[model samples]
Target chain A: MAYEQSVYLTGDHELVEEFGLLCYQAGYRVTGTAHPGPVRRKLPVFFRKSTLVPRSATVAMELTNVRTDLKRKNLKFLDGALPKGALLLSSSVTVAAHEQASWIAHPERLIGIAALPTFGGRKLIEMAPAPQTGKDALARSQAFFTRLNKEVAVIQDRVGMVLPRMVCMVINEACFAAGENVATPADIDTAMKLGTNYPSGPIEWANAIGFHQVTAVLEALYRDLGEERYRIAPLLRHFAGGNRWWET
Target chain B: MGTGIAYAAALASMDALLYDVTAEALERGFGKLRADIRQSVEKGKLSPERSEEILSRIRTTGALADLAPCGAVIEAIVEDLAVKQELFRTLSGICASDAILATNTSSLSVTAIASGVSSPERVVGMHFFNPAHIMKLVEIVEGHQTSPDALAAARGLAEAMGKKPVMAKDTPGFIVNRVARPFYGEALRLLGEGVTTAEEIDRIARLEGNFKMGPFELMDLIGIDINFAVTKSMYEQTFGEPRYRPHIIQQQMVHAGLLGRKTKRGFYSYPP
Candidate 1:
C-alpha cells in the first residue's frame, strides 16, 4: 500500500476547488491544480492528461460539474498514462461509477463520488465505486476520505448515488409541480419542510446548490437510465439555461 | 392510528368517541392512550391535571352510533380500499349530514373512499404522521368530490389541534409520503447494492445532510412494515413508476418480521 501523500486536482467548478482545499486542509499536499477553461466545447479529445499533473503523483481527483461528458473525456485521456497503483476519484453526481470507469482500461481504479456544492462545509463523502474496483483500491479510497475527517458511504456504482440523486429528483419534481401550477415554489418548499421534516425545501436547496447542477444531474440520469422518472422538468431546464424565475 | 388520532383530538379539547370493532380492542386503545398521556406528564411536557382532563374528554365505545353526535368523525382503520369504503359508507349514513367525515389514511385514495358514501363531498383525507400527537404536520387532502367547505373544516380541525396542515390533492402518498419515497428507497437500494452499510448512510445523512434522522433511522422508527406498505401502495397507484418502486431489501426485512421499533429489529437492532 504505497499511497502518495500528494494529490493532483483538476477541473474549474467550484466543487473542484473546494474539494482540493478540503484535501489540503485535511493535511494532504496538493501538488497541482488545473482549471481547464471551456474544454467541454473544444480540444476535449486531444488534451494530454499526463501534462496536467506531476508523473510522480499516485492520485488524481477530477472534479467537474454535472457535464458528465467532460469527466468521461478526461478519463479517456488518462487511460493512456494512468500511473500504476494510482486511484482516480471523479466528482460526478449524475454519471455512474461503472459507466465512467468503462472509458478507462483499468476500471478497477476509478471511483465516482458525488460532490455537492455544499460538500466543502461537511464531513461526509458519498462514494460510488465501479463493479470492477479492486479491494485495495476501495480501501485506499476509504483511507483518502478518512484522512479528510469525512465519513464515507461507499455506495454501489449508481448514477447520482444516494443523497444527490434523491435530492435532485426532489428539486425536479418541485419544479414540475410548480410549472403545472400544482403549488407555488414557496408553498411546495414549505410543505416539504413542514410536511416531511426535510432540512430545506427542494427549490431553496436547488438555489443553494445551483439550479444548473440540479438540472444537470436530472438530465444525466434521464440520458443514462432512459427513464421518465429522471426526466428534467422543463421549468428546471429553462431556469438552468439563463431563464430566471425569481429575482435571485 | 385510531389511538393516535384520539390522543390528538383529546389534547385539542375536542370530546372524541373512539369506536373500534370490539370492547376489548377499544379498551386496549384506551390503555395505550393513557400510557402516552402519562408519559407526556412524566416528561413534564403535559401537566398531570391536563393529562387527566384530556383523558376525561375521550370516551371509548364499540358502537357506530356513538360517533353520530360528533362534529367530526375521523376514521383510522385498515388500509384496504374496500374496507375503508364500506366504513365511510356506514359512517356517512349514521352521522349527521353536515358533519365532516375524514379518513386518516396515508395511501388509499380519498375520492375512492368517498365514492360509495351518500355525499362524497363531505369526505376528505386528514393524514397524520406517526405518533400523531407528536408529529406536527397533517395533510388535509381533497378528494375529487371533496367540497371546499370540507377541506376548510379539516384544515381548521388540524390547526385547532396545534398541527400544521398542508393541502394536497388526492394523489398517491399525498405530498410528504410521495415526495419522501426516494429518501428510503434510494438508501435501501444502496444497502442492497453493497455500496455502503446502513450505518454509514445513516451517519452521513444525520451529520453531513443535517437531517433530523437518517433514512434508515426514520424507517425503523416508522416501522418497516408500514413504510413498505406505503411504497407498495404508491408504486401500484403510480402505475409502476420506477421512482416509487419498493426495494426488495425492505420487502425481505418486513417478511422476516423485522418491523422496526415495534419488533425490536430492523435496519438496526433495538434493545427490547
Candidate 2:
C-alpha cells in the first residue's frame, strides 16, 4: 500500500478548519488544534494544548495571523515538536521566510508560504524558502502545493510575499478613499469593476478577506521595509479593529 | 472620447452639438459616430429609424459658438488645463449664464479648469471611461465651487445617458485612477525585485485572485506611456505623497519606447 501523507495544521479554530478542509481536498490526512490565545499571555504550547500531532505527520503548518506571533512562539514550538526531517510550512505574509527560520532548532525542513484563510479555492499557491531550507524541503514545498493542484510561485524571500503585498496595498488605498468619503462603498465598487475590471471592489474585497490580514500585512511591510508608503492607513486600522466596511 | 460621448448622448434621445475647430475633425467625428450607431442598429440594439434619428440628432460644427444653444456642453477636448480653462472662459461668455459646463477630463483637476471661468459653480466633471458608449460608469465630480444644482444636473444627465454616475470630490484621479494605481505600481515593484516573472504574476492574479486582467496585461492594453503619465500626475498632484509615487520601472519602460499593444512591446513580448 502507498504511504499516506499526513499534515499537522495549527492556528485559530476557523483558520485551522479552513486549511484542514483544503488539505483534505488534496487527499491528505489532517489533524489540527485551536491555538490557546496569544503566547504573550498563555503558557507553553505543549502544556496547554490538548491535541498532539501524530508521529507519522510529514507536513507541519503554522497559520499565525501576524508575523510577531510566529516569531515569538509558534516557530520554536513547531520546530521542537515535529519529527526529524518533516517539512514545516509557516505562514509568512508579514514576516520573511529567513527571519522565521532563525527561530527554529532545525530550519532545514522549514519553508514559508502564503496560504491565507479561504484560499482553498485559489489556483495558485505562493512559496519562498529560507537560506537554511534543504533541497528536499524546497522540492517538498513545490510537491506539497502540486498535490493541492495549485501552481507554485517561488519568489524572492520577502515580507508579505508577492500577492499579499500587492493586494493589500490596493486594499489600503481603497480604505483611505472610503474613510475620506470620496464615494460610498457601493459606488466605489461599481467604479472599480466597470472602470478597471478589478475582481471586486477594493473596499469590499478587503472586508471579504477580513481587514485584520490587510492591516497585518501593511504593518509588517512598513516595519520591515521602513518605507513611508507601506504605512497603514488610519481608516484601515479602524476596520481591522472589529469593524466591517460591509458584511459578507 | 468626444465622439463616443456624443453617440451616447444622441442615443439617449438628446440633441447633441459635436464641436471641433477643424472641418476635417468634425467630419471624422461624424463618420465614426455613424459607424458606431450602424453597428448598434445591425445588432438589433436600436431600430434603423432610431439609429438614423440618433445620427441626425448629432449636429457637427467648426465653431465653438454653436454650443451656445446647448443646455449642457460637455467638453472632451485635449487634456490641458490652460486650454480647458480658456475654452470654458470663452464658452461661459457665449452661452447663457445658467448653462452647465462639464469637462471629460480624467487626470486634470475639475477645480483648476473651473477657475477664472464665470460662475464656477456651473462647472463639473462628467468623466466617462474609454468607449464611453459602452462603459456604464461615469464619475460626477464636484470642484471647489461646483454647486448642488450643477451636480444634480450632471447626475441626471449621466443617468439619462444610461450611465451609472458616482459622486466624488475633485481629488486627483477622482476615484478610479487614484485608487487603482497600486495595481500597476506594486506589480512593477514586484517584477523589479525579481520576485516573479510578469507571466507568473499575471497567472496568479487571474487564477488566484480572479481579476479580469493581470496588472501587466492591463498596462499593455492601456499604453505604458499613458499609464506612466497618469501615475506621474497623481504623484505630483498629491504633493509628493509616498503612496502615489510613480515606479522607476514605468519611466524606464516608457523611455525604451516599449509601449504596450501600440508599440507591440512592454512587460511582455508580442510577436506581431
Off by over 4 Å in 2: A1-3, A12-14, A35-50, A70-72, A243-248, B38-50
TM-score on alpha carbons, each prediction: 0.81, 0.92
Chain A TM-score of each model, in the order shown?
A: 0.82, 0.88
lDDT of candidate 1 over B110-174, digit per residue (tens): 99999989999999999888788888888888999999999999999999999988788888877
Candidate 1 CAPRI category: acceptable
Candidate 1, true inter-chain contacts retained:
0.42
In model 1, the clashing pairs are: A154-B195, A155-B195, A156-B195
Local distance difference test, per candidate? 0.79, 0.83
Residues A159-194, candidate 1: write the lDDT tens digits.
676678767877877787777655567767877887
lDDT of 2: 0.83
Predicted candidate 2: what Cα RMSD to the true structure?
4.0
